[model samples]
Target: MPSMVLLAEYVSINGTDLSDYCRKAELTTKVEEKDVTTYGSAGWKELRGGLKSGELALEFLQDVSASALDSIMWPLLGTVVTFEVRTDQAVVGTSNPKYTGSVLINGWNPIQGSVGDEAKTSVSYPTSGAVSRATA
Candidate 1:
């Protein structure tokens, strides 16, 4: 297959376990078999939202052509563990990306007649206060 890669100006990743540990630790004090309580229920709960959101982003990427898959899934995801942003309308991007939103596929990718190196553009949006992103 040909090479496909998505680009974005920003990316973020979130993985918090402190609360989980604290809660579980507290629970253990109440139960006599506290040492036996090894299941990471709290951690699992926190991951649920992220997993669901990521699934939505992947489903959206399915609409992209095979050639665009790389730009939409590989490098951008590898580089960005949390959130992603694209200043330019390239690859997969949207005009309004929510905080920690999935990477937005280039929504306005077909623009032309610009200045500066074609490669210089990263994640960008006009002064419309819109939200552009690489996934969501």
Candidate 2:
């Protein structure tokens, strides 16, 4: 297998493509671990998968101008919105699988940095439903 470099990542939220302002994007899915240790004379513990959940984290180069990053995200602070992310902006296929799901916009940091620092924002949102990966 070959390694992949993240030069052009695709990120979309609520039908809006925000790839230009996004610097980093990540999607993670996991299942809850449930223990079911029985009285089977075995001294080992057994585990099972339970609930499934996911989360999406993004880092953006802030652009607070009119109709820019701030304006677009501020209005979606308290809602569940759809999102999609891929390794590259090119057509989705075996090399570039797309991850799509809904995330709850539970938090935001419009301004947080020191003087003379570059404007940027990092946020993590919990998924509201199933996260699917497809290549088409």
Candidate 3:
């Protein structure tokens, strides 16, 4: 049997819950492929896995409050920060099917629009190390 996990679950950054302000979030992992095709080999190309990398993207309703801007901006502008994504809308650490890791803030963009539009921010970062996955 197979089960589905909803996207409207828990999400946190540096142990702080940000699900309320978060509109979209995604974590992607990829591996670099190295071509290993050599002479006297088959006509088809061959590849070998080289390195692994990860990236995270988040979209949030822009807020200028201390907890919203100050908290996130400082880390994004300063150093690597930890983030966690859970399967349920509970406290981060208390939930299952979680992914946690540290990442360096790569880019941040605050968007502003005319009337009848909500302000938002989009940020993305590249993972520095392994992103641990937990299912229980």
Candidate 4:
């Protein structure tokens, strides 16, 4: 594998492509660690993988106009929406895999900034269902 600079990452939420407005994006998957150590163990602790979960976080350059970031995300609050992310805007293949999942829009910060700071909205959404990776 080679290094990635990620200049044209792709992000889509609820079927709307927000790649242009997205400043940052991340998709994370985690598995709960299950302790399997028993009294028979002398010193070593055993562990195994348990349930798996995922999350998608995004930071966007704020835009509140019609059909913009704010408009697209506001209505989806408290609901689970489909999302897809890719390393680049190109088609998904062996090199560029697409991650798709349903995320619960638990919270949103529409406006957050300081003087001279760029307007931005950052959201971290928990996956409501299984996350899938496709290279097709």
Candidate 5:
């Protein structure tokens, strides 16, 4: 399969670096793919090698400017939903010819999803069930 490094930290992205959105985090603090199953699927792991791992050239961003981007990618990801997408058999990005490190989305949102199986999102525990998914 593919390999990826998911470092969740506060990050600023500029339109130029959209392809390779780097994660800013302490090397000691890492979220392994195995642990992610508690929330989402393992498919997201490939992101590490494509660009986050410093493998390919990427466009870096400093702020969230929606109109400036070729497209709006953030909206695609459910506010807090996860979906298991149908991927190729092998390590898709590595073996495939077209690869850059950008997370592909459906128009503006992510093609996969943000929550559990089939993208039925759960309320954020932090908000006391106040947070919910917005369908477009």
Candidate 6:
């Protein structure tokens, strides 16, 4: 049988716990493919791996608290920071797999709202280095 994980897991950014405020989290990895076709007998094109990149998108319930706002605003608008995502709720020691790496905030929308909807913010960051996965 295959195992399935819930979305209500844990995620932390620069040591601040944002799991409670986060409503959605997505991680994407992409690799560039380059054509390596040469003058060969085969007419089919060949391809080679070029580069790899990773991105993370997060949606959070807007919070006015100093910790929540400041933590996210600064990193999203200012500099690169470290982020971690876990497969479980446990923050300290756990057997769940965790992804950790540094990322530069590429885009941030402070507010997304309408008349009867919840106030939310969506932020996207581009991973700087290799995103490592390990069990803690």
Residue 135 in model 5: shift from native, Å?
Answer: 37
Rank all candidate structures by their lDDT, best first, as comma-separated numbers: 2, 4, 6, 3, 1, 5
lDDT (0-100) at residue 77 of candidate 6?
A: 64
Error of 4 at 109 (Å): 1.1
Candidate 2 lDDT over residue span 1-136, tens digit each? 9787899999999989999999999898999999999889398899999999999999998999999998999999999999999999999999999999999999989997899989999999999989999998
Best by TM-score: 2
Mark the regions of model 6 whose C-alpha exceeds 4 Å error after superposition. Answer: 70-72, 91-95
| Highest lDDT model number | 2
lDDT of 6 by residue, 23-135 (tens): 88887878899998988928998998889889888888888777675456655565688899876686546467788898886666766889998988888889988898876
State residue 72's C-alpha deviation in candidate 6, in Å. Answer: 4.1
Runs with alpha carbons beyond 4 Å of true place in candidate 4:
none
lDDT score at residue 61, model 2, on the 0-100 scale: 89
lDDT of 3 by residue, 1-136 (tens): 9786676766787778888888888899999999999885668888999999998888888887776754566556647889887767754453457898998876666555678888877778898899988764
Q: What's the lDDT for all of these models? A: 0.28, 0.94, 0.78, 0.93, 0.26, 0.78
Candidates in order, TM-scores: namely: 0.18, 0.97, 0.81, 0.96, 0.18, 0.84
Score candidate 4 by lDDT.
0.93
> Any idea what lDDT model 1 has?
0.28
Model 2: lowest-lDDT 10 consecutive positions: 37-46
Clashes of each: 37, 0, 0, 0, 15, 0
Clashes of 6: 0
**lDDT assessment of candidate 5:** 0.26
Off by over 4 Å in 5: 1-59, 69-71, 79-96, 100-136
**Candidate 5 structure, TM-score to reference:** 0.18
Question: What lDDT tens digits, residue by residue, belong to model 1 across residues 1-136?
Answer: 8563443333222221112111111000011222322366643432211111221121111223453432333343323233332332244435533333323323323223356523111222111122233345
